[model samples]
Target: MHDLLFTVPGDEFPFTASVVVHVDGPRHVVRRTAGGDVHEVECTADDVDRVVDEALEALLAPIQVCRACGTPSASPDFTAVFERMHYICFHFEFEHGDADRDQACGLAGCPAG
Candidate 1:
């Protein structure tokens, strides 16, 4: 297993997570300081790529963009999850929020709602 540390922006600040990737396929270990260890299901290569992309976004320290107007959120973490729509993109406020969502681009500043 190759352990890699990825830094991401938290609600208040930046944080780092340690990801131990198996040389083989599927299983991996992910741990964050605030949230402790996170258990992930068997993930595909696409999932890994997505996570890496998110980390890169955090590196830029981007203000979360509104799912509606493409506006960079002035107060991203404070934006309410108004009318949970779908995965337009970015700022994963909730992990399971995308479980039953559509790709509609209209929910005000609900960045991850």
Candidate 2:
């Protein structure tokens, strides 16, 4: 069990959570945070690598990126989740009004050229 804490961009409280991951043959038992968010996922042992990759992306700090026409932009907490035996990338953008959904490139300070 490891607690991953990410400093939120503000004077407010930071995002803190605990994640426990264990392998059980072709299944993984994941207990994230102490708020009772437990998940039992069915996946191949090979999927562990993918879980690690997703978890790393989720637990790490956020970096800037330019995914909209190669223009500098700020993004919210970057995270990836593996649920229902699938990997899904996510971000919490508090600003930037948009009526449509566009995927932002996972790069900080991508050149605008």
Candidate 3:
């Protein structure tokens, strides 16, 4: 069994929450705790990649503007990097800057926070 920690932006709140994904063979479980509330989902891991993708999409579904400049785009610039050491950096961008793209964007009032 393996586990990974991910930060997911809240939908109704302007804060980010930590999600723990537990993978055990063909079974995958996602858990989140916030504001004294705990949410979890258990499903058959038919496709691990697809499940992760869908979970990430649902986590950031409430974000409508760019994390950096608050620019609205139908298809915003989003990136996620997973390293061999189990480090994950996920964020959104509206414009390129001199900063590293593999780092998370800690923008206030943004989902990437």
Candidate 4:
């Protein structure tokens, strides 16, 4: 389990983005969520390059339900996986659930905290 911590700013909200990549027998499992999903890619256990490629693919897969919003993103995959996931996790933290809405969402149009 890799715990990736990021946030828009102190003013917006706080959230954690996590991705776990682990070998389970013959495949590599990629897991993350803001109550979203997990993905698995097939690869040999010893092939580091394959493992990385599979992991990145899993992370970059287009979402039917965007973690930032229920609808599909306008332009997804324009950024690095971590950058995109960080925004998703941050947005979800503030926009969903019992969130404090007074602050800017910080996904866009806000000072960097």
Candidate 5:
């Protein structure tokens, strides 16, 4: 399970931005904070993939979604993976749900995550 938290300024409308994404196994809870308003989204899946590569890709998607909304972001630097701790970055890749075989980054020397 993973939970990602982000704080958006009290502006920027017409663009639905991603604020916080809470993951518990296959279920997802996406919460939004913008314009002094708060919204919650819930996604439920049957099970969470545990493969090393899939787990890594699953870890990066929310930040990618966030960066698409014009929020300030840092380069997609590699960060340590702590237990249940979240990563915040600007990198994105479409996994097709198969991180091991999908080479989305396309960069020769870059890591999958």
Candidate 6:
């Protein structure tokens, strides 16, 4: 089994993001963390690159709608989460909108109303 870690930082998050990738035979696991929150996911290890790509897509794919105005954000900031010793892309907050309300539009808890 192989393990990998990464740090993602940007203006949106304003924090150091941590991600971990684990490859074990046919099972692949990822954990990621940002802003003190953690999230993880698992999949078949067809290929390391493929698994990472799919996992990241799955994490960022859900922010198509603007949780604050329900109008779909033109540009969204993305990040990841962590679990114990693993990580994956699962944390995100919307940008380019009402700065007062944007902080409330996180991917993990968007009212989308």
Q: How do all models score by TM-score?
A: 0.30, 0.33, 0.41, 0.26, 0.30, 0.38
Give lDDT tens digits, candidate 1, residues 1-113. Answer: 56666543354434434333443455543333324656443456657666554444434334555554555555544334522223333433443345444442345654434
- TM-score for predicted model 1 compared with the true structure: 0.30
Off-target runs (Cα >4 Å) in candidate 6 are 9-15, 47-51, 54-113
Backbone collisions counted per model: 0, 1, 0, 0, 0, 10
Cα deviation at 9, candidate 2, in Å, is 16
Q: 41-84 in candidate 4: lDDT tens per residue?
A: 44455774665644544443544234454344445553454234
User: Could you tell me which 10 consecutive residues in candidate 5 have the lowest summed lDDT?
Assistant: 82-91
* Runs with alpha carbons beyond 4 Å of true place in candidate 2: 1-15, 34-40, 61-113
Cα RMSD of all models vs. native, in order, equals 10.8, 12.4, 12.2, 14.0, 13.2, 13.9
Candidate whose lDDT is highest: 3
lDDT by residue (82-113, candidate 5, tens digit) is: 22222322223332233454354554433443
> Candidate 1, which ten residues in sequence have the lowest lDDT sum?
82-91
Off by over 4 Å in 1: 8-39, 51-73, 77-113
lDDT of each: 0.44, 0.38, 0.53, 0.44, 0.44, 0.50
Residue 40 displacement (Å), model 4:
2.1
Given candidate 3, what's the lDDT at residue 73?
38
lDDT of 2 by residue, 9-87 (tens): 3424333544456665556654444234443344466675676555533433333323223222333432222121111
lDDT of 6 by residue, 2-105 (tens): 99866542324443455679888788888776557777778665565776764454443444433333333434342222211111112223231443443554
Maximum-TM-score candidate? 3
Estimate the lDDT of model 5. 0.44
Q: lDDT tens digits, residues 52-80, model 3?
A: 65666555545543444544334433433
Window of ten residues with lowest summed lDDT in model 6: 81-90
- Per-residue error for 11 in candidate 1, Å, reads 13
Evaluate candidate 4 by giving its C-alpha RMSD to the native, one decimal: 14.0
Q: Which model is ahead, 5 or 6, in terms of TM-score?
A: 6
